[model samples]
Target chain A: MLSSTVENYLKSLFLLDPRGEKEVATGELAKSLEVTPGSATSMIKTLAQAGLVEHRPHYGVRLTSQGRTLAVHVVRRHRIVELFLVNVLGMDWSEVHEEAEQLEHVVSDEVITRMDDLLGHPSHDPHGDPIPSADGTLPTRTLQTLSFCNEGDNVSIARIGNQNTEFLKFAEDNGLLLGRTITIKNKNEIADSITITTHEKEVVLGLAAAGKIEVEHV
Target chain B: MLSSTVENYLKSLFLLDPRGEKEVATGELAKSLEVTPGSATSMIKTLAQAGLVEHRPHYGVRLTSQGRTLAVHVVRRHRIVELFLVNVLGMDWSEVHEEAEQLEHVVSDEVITRMDDLLGHPSHDPHGDPIPSADGTLPTRTLQTLSFCNEGDNVSIARIGNQNTEFLKFAEDNGLLLGRTITIKNKNEIADSITITTHEKEVVLGLAAAGKIEVEHV
Candidate 1:
């Protein structure tokens, strides 16, 4: 089993440059890890030796195919655990991120398989992130950012952004998660908030929040 | 927050020497972690510095008051995660251990509290191990060994001694688990097979399998 620190490094690297074909800057990785350049330097070298990463010092790092596989596995585990926390454990939507982050690295394929079964083989998590299929194929999506839509356009939420809790609470409070309709009641440019009616409640989403969310034309 | 690896070390120490509060021997820890003595020594030093453990060379390690509190938290998380996997995720009872082991370190107090609520604050996990309450109190009970049970003794599984799939299959085939009730019908002293009636199934539990089970007489 990989250490949490190692996995975190790999996850960050994968997120920055998922396919080994792209090279990430070393300083960027160091910044993302919140570690000194020296520590990141040593660990990246180690990961390269392990064949989990391909690092070219100044040019940065990328996950090898083996490493990408592992990163996706971790991401799938994170999303599955998050959904389980919300849909099954009854956790508040605002609270699943930190918990899932911690759990994603520890659960095994056996546990994940069972989780998938328990969730009725859900195609998406409670937050609208796609749940990778059994074979690790993520469902391809064609979603648009709500901020880019015209003022009167009707849209449906396709995915919620994986950011902080305030955003999640705002989204949940508005019932603007996946498969929910947003009528784009109004866009307030002065205050930079968008008004949308959902589940019979009016939500004033900040332009920043609306920008983060992905939507599809209705 | 302690990492799962660190939490596992603390929990292992807690379980290995629950009564006396004696220091855990390095050799014993190495055995449990499946690492070398030198590796264990190095890690213990790190743990001691981190204030999670106290170490004396020949004497085994022990948890400080702070460490004990952390261990209790990990235990709470593990039991909650296990219950969530089973009750919510629809994961098989046999598959929850590793997942719980990883998740125990990362879940938040909010998630744990809510999980307890969703489960109606279950007092025990699927393995019949008492779950520590939100306040960290474990219900005291004297559990018995199934191997030593006499004829007509009604027993419920407390914890499976091992997590091998073979054990799970056997338990599943016979409808035996943490809450299963069993009445010992006959014990073959020669062939070492015990005939037991569980629910409506008359099953023969081999000595090897029966020996690995811990039970409680009701």
Candidate 2:
């Protein structure tokens, strides 16, 4: 019966350091959660006492193995809920993230398992974000961003690093969907833009936007 | 957003006095919520200040129109979630209630609307409890319990007034499901039991259990 607050903290910790190789600074955690640094420190202390995290004072905080497991479960719930909202409820992918945020805390593992079964055990969500398996292991796929693609390189969309709603809508509008193939026509470092050809049309994207679009060699 | 605590209080109030004609005693409210009388009184005061209830000292409390509307919406969410769990997720009817209790608080109006649509706007939940409309109006159908039926009376199960999980499981085990037709075989007032025939089999039940099974004249 962990509070949603505790779950959010652990989830944020896991996201901030997916490999659990580095401690996240209290200030950075506070900024990510939109809470004051003092509040984050106090919560970190509590989590340390509960053995969910190790607080290294001025160094920062890192989740314990127990905390990481809980955090991965939360992430799994979020991704599953997002897919269910879009694939079953017919909701837009851009709007489901916010809905899934609230639901991930309240939904039961039983319901999540049922949803996963109903969805045919999808490996990825609607946004191409990899869904953690029932055992809490993420898919191990090395992907390169569109920005790093060389001219004439053929690639297919794999995942979207940026989950902003506006960015998702823009991706949908430009037909840059998961599994869609594209060819890098130009990469102008000076202009900070990358031009790609998809669906028989050329689309130009700034380097920042291109970097958010993860792709795999076709 | 109303905390789940506030929503629970409102929901309990509505269930205790569905017609909003009678005021529910503070002691009764406390027992229903499994909270102390002092805690229930304090929450009642908060609800009163918010114009959700009219509290009469030493008498009882009743919901204002605003409060009743909110309570009805919570009920709607609970029933819809219950049906979605049972119908869509293939969960057992007896197990969905606890899951719905947690979910009804966090689920958004948009998701509930989608579920309602997906369920084809079902009028009643799996347990035969009428679902409140989007406008917060409940269906007005008067039904009689099996205990009140005369010997040889023919009726069909309409709703199970008792929502206790064990009772529902017992009902299921005995084939006393909604829409099933039954014929009263005998009424033993001295023994406080009723005998009914269903599926060409005679079953005997205590008056209390019989009283919980609401039925409609066939």
TM-score of chain B of 1: 0.87
Per-model C-alpha lDDT, please? 0.79, 0.93
How well is each residue in A47-165 modelled by candidate 1, as lDDT tens digits?
Answer: 99999988777777888888878777777888888888778767776778877887787777877787777788888887777777767678767788887777788888888776588
Q: Per-residue lDDT tens digits of candidate 1, residues B1-218?
A: 56557887878777677653577788887887778999888888888998878887677778887788777778888888888778866777777876677677767788788878878988888776678887768876677767778888888877776766667767887877777888999888688888888887998877877887888887
Clashing pairs in 2: none
- The interface RMSD value for candidate 1 stands at 2.3
Error of 2 at A135 (Å): 1.9
Q: What is the C-alpha RMSD of each candidate to the true structure, in Å?
A: 4.5, 1.6
Fraction of native Cα contacts reproduced by each candidate: 0.96, 0.83
Q: Per-residue CA lDDT of candidate 2, range A100-189, in tens?
A: 999999998999999999999999998888799989899878999999999999999999987789999988888898999999999999
For residues B72-137, what per-residue lDDT tens digits would candidate 2 score against the true structure?
999999999999999999998888888899899988899999999999999999888999999998
Task: Highest TM-score: give the candidate number.
Answer: 2
- Chain A TM-score of prediction number 2: 0.97
In model 1, how large is the Cα lDDT of residue B8?
79
